[model samples]
Target: MVQAQDASEEAGTEASGGDEAAEDAQAMMTDESAIDDQAAREFFTSGSNLYSLGRYHDAALQFQQAYDLSERPALLYNIYLAHRDASEHAEAAVALRLYLEATPDADNHAALTVRLENLERGLAEQEASRVSAATAAEEAVRQEQAERERREAEERALAEDDKNIIPWIIAASGGAVMAVGVVTGIIALGLASSLDENCEPAVDGVRFCPSDPSLELENKQSALSTFAVMTDIFLIGGGVIAAVGLTWGLVRLGGAEDDEDAPTVSAMCGPTGCGASMRMGF
Candidate 1:
């Protein structure tokens, strides 16, 4: 009987030891759960602070972390709210769908489902608008490029036309010189008429002046001779220059018509003299 009582005491000690071990394990699990809850609370507070500061995307990330730690359907709703405020419709829809799936018996399930459909439709419209804007921008760039090319082509053609401008300038200069000659001739004729009216008839082409001959009559005769010489010089020189310019222009025009790659000729006239230049390309 004494040995039996000793065995019972030994069994009682083992059972008490097992109870202590089980209690310790329960305490450890409780501590771990408290740590997790504290971490989740910190994340939830950070998310709330970010949302209040209008940092919606950052808030969404914080709330997602909270939801991961807590596995709470309510935290998913907070994530959806953050994503929605940030205009992340797709992400908001995903979060809301996850919340609905996690909590099938939610009171607002029907309303939330309708809202998801609307969000999806709006997302589709947004995508379509973005594509249309991109296409319009591409078309605009294409039109601008084509317009630039056309303007460049016209400028090139104008540059080619400018190559023939020297001939016209020479011709105009010659015409102006000829006009001056005609006016000088007219003045010479007027002076001669005045001289004839004042001078008397003479023998051997020597005019006989009055005994008291006026100095004005002699000056008039001198002026008439000078003007006549000037008229002849101007008319002849101007005619030659004009003819040269016109002939050069005709030759260039003919050459251009015959061959696009023909030799080119250019003429110029100035106060000193007139000149011709030629260029040949092979």
Candidate 2:
């Protein structure tokens, strides 16, 4: 009988221990719930303050935190409100759906449903406009690039044509001047022949013969000297100009062996006559 009584006392002690454990668990849960409620209240207060300050994005974040802390449908509605006010229709729609799911029987279900539909429609339109704008901008850039390339090609072509024509023009001008010189030299030679014939026997004889004294012969000799000097000037100048043009043309045509060297022209006009020389380098 005493052993039976001791067994009953052990059972009684076990029961008392179980009750204390249950009490401790309940207290822990209450503390956790209180902490969560305090966190939710703080988040909600911050969210409201942000909303009042017109900081919708920050307000949305704060509201999202409050929902995370307490999982309250009302907090989600506040998040939706913040997102809508911020013009973030996509996020607002998502928040609205969550609110509807959490509280299907909420009194404002009809109003929220209408709001969500409007947000969805706005989201669709915004997405369409963004896509259209992107396409137009890309096309504009492509056209601008094409126009720029065409302009550049045309300018290059014109420049290349100028480069090709300049040398030809110089060469033609030089040839014309040289022709003039040749013609003038022939006339001067004829005049010299007449002067010599008048002086004496005109076979390679240019010395003044005292045997024939005439003022007309002296004047003809003076004219011959002037013509000879003029002829030399034209010939030398023309030859230098022609050489410059030909050298430039050959260099441009990539036909010159030593294109690195540049040709130079020099002129001399002494008491005797005018003459020109070309220092052909390379």
Identify the candidate with maximal lDDT: 2
Q: How many clashing residue pairs appear in each of the predictions shown?
A: 0, 0
List, residue by residue over 1-282, the lDDT tens digit for candidate 2. Answer: 000011111112233655988766766777777777777778788888899999999989988887797777778888988998998888989999998888889888888799788878888998999999999999999999999999999999898879666767777788888888898899889888887676665444354744435567777777787778878887888877887888777777774544345467788877677877766655
Instruction: Write down the lDDT of every candidate, Cα atoms only.
Output: 0.74, 0.77
Candidate 1, residues 210-267, lDDT tens digits: the string is 5435688777666766776667666666665666567656667766533344445565
TM-score of each: 0.55, 0.67
Candidate topping TM-score? 2
Off by over 4 Å in 1: 1-36, 45-59, 71-74, 97-114, 141-166, 186-221, 244-282
Clash list (residue pairs), candidate 1 = none
Candidate 2 has its poorest 10 consecutive residues by lDDT at 1-10
For model 2, how many clashes? 0
True-structure lDDT of candidate 1? 0.74
lDDT of residue 75 for candidate 2: 81
Candidate 2: the clashing residue pairs are none
